[model samples]
Target: MSTHFEERSGVILCRTSWGSWYQTMEEVFIEVNVPHGTSGKEVRCNLGSKHIELHVKGQEIFKGKLFGTTVSDEGTWTLEDKCLIRIVLMKTNREAGNCWASLLEGQYCADAWVQDQMQRKLTLERFHRENPGFDFSGAEISGNFAGGGPDFSNLQK
Candidate 1:
């Protein structure tokens, strides 16, 4: 059967200006694909120099070096029921390009990382191919509500 996941290298929806790629707020996003049953404590993302290491139980699950700007300190993640980790990486003016253009450039990831992802996609495709009567589950990749953003405005007396 067809699963809910998409075979994506990386999908970066930049909130840029219409005229030019101007991000009013210095921010970007990172979407991580987590397995069906993953706990919040089990997942860890160490961000440094546009590189990220996803670890579960102190073991690296996914390792890839992003080609975009450095991941800002300000960001949030939502882990949905299906176990998709959506991380919104806050960006800064210091970094260069946004996420969308960056990930497309090179294969800056490990073979295991690439193989694991490809296998997942292939498995789904195979299931559909084999089962003629199979239908999609329509399972959406969602996340839990962590917290709100920082208050930029001044407090009233």
Candidate 2:
């Protein structure tokens, strides 16, 4: 019930049988490994607003609804090293600065540990944005800084 993802350069990368995927605030990157010597014509990908279907060498590698909406026109895929397929999807709501937990809907969600790290990273970024006077680049966030913990607004004697 849990998916393990590796964090690289502040981005959490989820690896699956098909391949691996990672996302930024504005784009989603997908890498699919194909058979050696597989040509570009052997790979077919369809990226819609919320749907994705990829085929390699006539084999269905992945097909499902995306977890978030994207600009279909901006989505692109290219074959690399004659065997790997790299895809880039531009998120439609880039201005909102939201992170996607998974590539496909109801699939590959981040585990508790990953989720916590993501929460902390997002919180740190928000803090830096709101308070630009101070440098919080190296600050580490501990505990439940996102609220829902015990409230101590009023201390009792």
Off by more than 4 A, model 1: 1-26, 57-61, 94-100, 108-157
> TM-score for every candidate vs. truth?
0.41, 0.72
* lDDT tens per residue, model 1, 9-116: 222233211111112123434455556788888878776557656675577655676545555466566667756666555555321112133331354322443433
Query: Which residue pairs in model 1 clash with each other?
Result: 27-91, 78-143, 79-143, 80-142, 80-143
Expressed as tens digits, the lDDT of each residue in 112-137 for candidate 2 is 67656655555555555445565555
Cα misplacement distance, residue 134 of candidate 1 (Å) = 45
**Pairs with backbone N, CA or C atoms under 3 Å apart (clashes), candidate 2:** none
Model 1, residue 45: distance off in Å is 1.1
Q: After superposition, how far is residue 149 of candidate 1 from its true place, in Å?
A: 30
Q: TM-score of model 2 relative to the true fold? A: 0.72
User: How far off is residue 72 in model 1, in Å?
Assistant: 3.0
Counting clashing residue pairs in each candidate, in order, gives 5, 0
Error of 2 at 107 (Å): 1.9
